[model samples]
Target: MKPVLLFLVSTAWTLTGAQYYYQGLMDYLENRLLAIEDRMQFWHEQSHRYHTELKDFKKLTTEAMDALSKEHSLLFKDLEGASVRVDRVEREMDYVESQTSPRACANKADKVVEQGAWGLEESRGEEEEEKDWEEVQSKVSDCVEILSGIRSVKILKRVGSPKGMWTRDPRSSKVYVFNGTSGDSIYQFNSVRDFSSSLGVSSSREIRLPSEFSGTGSSVYNGYLYYIQQEDETDVQVVRFDLMTGMVTDIAMFPVESHALVYSLNPETVADLAADNEGLWLLYAASDNEPNIHLAKMDPDTLDIEQIWDTRCPRENAEAAFVVCGTVYVVYNTRLASRSRVQCLFDVNDMIVSEEAPLLYFPRRYGAHASLKYNPEEKQLYGWDDGYQIIYRLTMKRKLLV
Candidate 1:
């Protein structure tokens, strides 16, 4: 019985020792887990703070970039303004110089206009001489023969402002002239015969164009007059005028930056507007460069620029333009005072000027500020002279290579 009691006491001591060791181990493990949790929480807080900072940093960088971009654009605009100012100053200087030292042709012409009977006779003699020379030249040259055959009969007197667009209705042979800047006067003819009759007695109508259409020139297609005008200070718009309905429609609006050539000046606005069977054409020069004519084909409906010709017109002072059978004929004035003009033909497909020598003349009676149109039906050319205030018709004496 003693041995049994001793063994029981020993076993009880061992169980108490094991319980104390297990309790101690559980407390240590809990302390370690708490420490690990605290470390993880610290790391997570650091990560979140870094993420916030990174986002703020990115936002700041973008804002900075945008601000810099804005500054750059403003600087560029200021520079462009400076360049334009310089150009204007240069042109003014040139004009002043020209006035001081007149050209020989201008001086001679001015002398005749200023002098009385002597001047008149001199001018008349010069004109007669030029006419005789032209006659002889026409007989000599094939191109001149065709150009010479063009008879410019005075059809109308004092149509409108010198700066205007002229076109004829193919269906009715009615002549229509649109003066965009000068009170929007649209001179419309009722019949071919009415063109010669006295203004009040003539069977014709004069109406104000739409208030918004501020065009320099225009083309007629499918019985609609299509023109490009200032949409706003910076935008140019293509619009259509329906003669039958007298309704004006906005076809498209493009920023002036699109062409960088549509001038704000009265004389050098859009040089000309023309249309053929294929599409509409816009004749513009890049930034007051009157000599370089840029021809572009525009979509009639969408007003999208479909194609820009690679050909650069090799002429200065191109006042009137017309497209026939894919050949663009431009009326260029070599001398503003004299009736000296050159008609240059540019082929759109070839992008080169035709080998045909320039028709060294236009209607002698018509003045510098004139608009040209080709009558496909009659196979003739018509011009409205602003200086002379007359409408003239031209027909080729021989078949043109075009």
Candidate 2:
């Protein structure tokens, strides 16, 4: 009985120790759970504060945007008001200027009358030029009639300038060619008022040119003189003369079709023509063809069939086009209206295209078969209008600057 009671007491002691250990572990776990809940509550408070601040920030940003929009609207209104005031001031100034000036319109009218008187003088000049043309035409007609038998007079390039009026030989290279009559008689520009003094024509032996080879068309380059030659044959052809050897060489044989006359100041198209310095260039067309730009280049000396270059001619640009100082000046006309379409400046070397500038005004109606010349010495461009036979000496100006 005593040994059994001792064994029961030992078992009771072991069960009490296990119960104590389990109770301590449960108390520790409950404390840890409370600490975790406290940390979670703190985080929730912080998160709520951040969300409220974010909402307030968004509201402020929207308000600021609204204010900025209003400010922009006000600025735009101010600018509009300023522009209106400026326009009003300009109008008032213009009115005052007109009132104070010697009526510019009246002055312009007087100038037109004065110009009318000048036109009378020009009319007389034209009369004289007409006589000269008759003589030229007679000679040209003679040549053409003779040339028709040779190759059929198909193409013609008329080369002449106002300077021809003062030439000593009317039948000289640029205007006339005849049978080498007498040396002095053959060189016939002496018909002009100042022929004797100009050529110093003394005797028939002084042969400046052969009588058989004088015409109104002349080209000089590379230390040689070139003139148009039509032999006594039925074909009217153009030929080049060697001033050194006194020999004639044939050049172009134009197409044998009836086409409108086209003229060009581009040395390239003329083949014999040349632009000595950087200056204005011109291209003239006389026929009624769908306008487009055309370009050509040739060696002035050899004239070895000049190759074509790039051109600014629009699809409807006039049938003729030319360049000056590397800038392209074109006459664009289709039916009746024509305007000067000068293109941007281009480099002759690199062929680089740059900014473009329109001249004077919107393109204006102009005469076809017009002649343009630039005197670098005068910095002026001279044009001859064949329609009414007028001369226009134009200088570059800041146009339409009202």
Indicate which candidate wins on lDDT: 1
How well is each residue in 1-402 modelled by candidate 1, as lDDT tens digits? 999999999999999999999999999999999999999999999999999999999999999999999999999999999979976875565345333321111112221121212222244577775764444334222221123223435545565566565667665667776653434557777654566564532346775567544545666776777766664556666777787888886567643343344322235454356765455777665454444567778876666788776345644555566775455766666454435344555555432234434343543454565466665555555565663335445443322211
Q: lDDT tens digits, residues 280-350, model 2?
A: 12222223262333334444444444444444444343323333444344444444534443332333432
- Give me the runs in candidate 2 sitting further than 4 Å from their true place: 1-238, 241-274, 278-291, 315-321, 337-347, 350-355, 360-366, 375-382, 387-402
How much is 262 displaced in model 1, in angstroms?
Answer: 7.0
**TM-score of every prediction relative to native:** 0.53, 0.33
| CA deviation > 4 Å runs, candidate 1 | 1-155, 200-203, 255-268, 288-291, 387-402
Give the CA lDDT, 0 to 100, for residue 22 in model 1. Answer: 97
Candidate 1 residue 206 Cα shift, in angstroms, is: 3.7
> Could you tell me which 10 consecutive residues in candidate 1 have the lowest summed lDDT?
102-111
TM-score of 2: 0.33
